[model samples]
Target: MKLATQAIRHVDLFAGIGGLRRAFDAVGSHCTFSSEWDGFSQQTYEANFRDNRKVDGRDLRDVQAGEIDDHDILLAGFPCQPFSIAGVSKKNSLGRDHGFADLTQGTLFFDVVRILKRWRPAGFLLENVKNLKSHDGGRTFEVIRRTLEEDLGYELHYRVINALHYLPQNRERIVIVGFKEPTSFSWDRLVLPPIGQTKMSSILHPEDGSEDPEGEYTLGPRAEVNSKYTLSDKLWNYLQGYAEKHRAAGNGFGYGLVGPDDTCRTLSARYYKDGSEILVKQDGRRNPRRLTPRECARLMGYDDTFRIPVSDTQAYKQFGNSVAVPVFEEVARIMLPEIERIKKSKPQTLQAVA
Candidate 1:
């Protein structure tokens, strides 16, 4: 797909392994700045992209808005831990606040707001978990909407897009797109591919002689899935017992078993602890295996060329925390023309800044 002919400079914030960066790169945008603090993730990001200048390995909170480079578009997935359903539940169980109530991570959105207010980029794209809309009984989303539309005067549009329509995983995330001035920005333009078109087979390792070997992930010249990926007998039995207990308690906690034809559940950061959410079905034994880090990369819509410079644990977390690339790629495709249009000519109907 052809991207905008004109160059669009964008900064990557909370840039986990550069998933968003790859999406914008799919179109013809230049990443002028990037911020990611995690050492492992930064390692992977740096390994994948050679042009890693302006890549800050510090807390974005410490950086002032004036410190950021001027760009036509701002792209941020922002930390979703404070607003995500799992995050909220985990915090609530621990008797802690969530959403905008949590001071540390929750208020990071304000930083995005801070930068938006300073540079006033022609357009921006923000992504988060699907639960962000209903977090804090809709108050969280309300504040976000008001901040962009009322306070900063940006034309905002958002929607919860499912990755099943474009990938083998059933991940859903809310993408918020905003234009500095009024323009034709519509969600209808992002035409999603048919659901179930892609299956586990697309991303899963065949374990046969079909793929190339990638160090320990795949074995020998045949490149079969490494035996290490298969769960041990003790852990497999424990997970089954735990699932049975939860089932008896009328709780929905269990390992997701999927074959080559089925779709997998959302990959999470905790996948490193236990690959319960998404376990590949195996024959002969009742046990299933965790997806290899390379497979996780493909599951996140990253191409084979993308390097996994980190450990398996960190790779799982990074890809789990990443946005589905194709989904965002299509979103970028639709947003590019609008971004280009807005950049070319200033809009007359600028919303009054509050």
Candidate 2:
């Protein structure tokens, strides 16, 4: 897993609960600076990391480029709302602009550009919704590509990878990898495990006395999923009726009721309000249930050792917003050699001048 003899230093921007950090760290990268503006997310990051490197609390826009410490790589998930399908549709319904036209969130990508322009880390890995390539009729991606390749002068490669290849969820995200200098890097290095090999049963809490009880996340001794996770009669019926109405109108909108053998729909931040997207099926005459926060953690490729020090609602939001960890792990594995090569070539380039 060690890509270099020395630890590869990295900075994390918009680090939600350190999902990307976990992947990079797995490849022996050392995180030097981490930024996450949300107080709750910051708390979770701090609780888990507990390191000497201070987590940056200020907004990324407010922090100047020089403030970020020099590092080998930059990792950012950034805000995806400007380009995500769900986010675009929601904004349109609200009569708001999206995809770099929205005054509020759409401009945050510029922050990443500014940092890259100034610091020019040896390499970077940026992630967002797959729809980013098509956002704003492809103009948004065009600008991003031009800025990174033409203006900033970096070698870029990208792919829209599906987490279903690794996890039991149909989450697709576009990953962008850039290098200060090109090396033998290719997407072919990523090897996806067979789909459907992992099932919902892997992450779902075994209510049948097979697991030990976790604090607050489970009930008495057997660690059965909390009864509160089960959908109420009213909500379940309402969702069924709503799905019927959508079906009548020839719409695909409906709750996702999945059993142990099935994969799940994309987990979203809205899962807190109503776990409609992925409801775990139950035995005869009983209500389906929402994933416990712990289960959600597993679904996102987090091990049980990862602490969830926030409320259930906040936990749901953080995990939902997080990149699939195993997906990033394979990405880091592939990007490591290129990142290492760029760093090694730097001193040689400078020594020629000296």
lDDT of each: 0.89, 0.89
Q: Per-residue CA lDDT of candidate 2, range 1-354, in tens? A: 555566688899999899999999998899989999999999999988989866898989999888787788999998998899999999999999999898677888889989888777888999999999999889999999999999988999999999888889999999999998867899999989987688898888887778888877788777777788889999999999999999999999999999899999999988998899999988874799899999999999999889999999999999999999999999999888787777777653211110
TM-score of 1: 0.96
Residue 330, model 2: lDDT of 94
Candidate 1: count of backbone clashes, pairs at least 3 residues apart or interchain: 0
By how many angstroms RMSD does model 1 differ from the true structure? 2.6
| Candidate 1 deviant stretches above 4 angstroms | 52-54, 346-354
The true-versus-predicted C-alpha distance at residue 216 of model 1, in Å, is 0.3
Mind giving the per-residue lDDT tens digits that candidate 1 earns over 92-193? 999999888899899999999988887888899999999999988898999999999999899999999999998889899999999977887788887888
Candidate 2, poorest ten consecutive residues by summed lDDT: 345-354
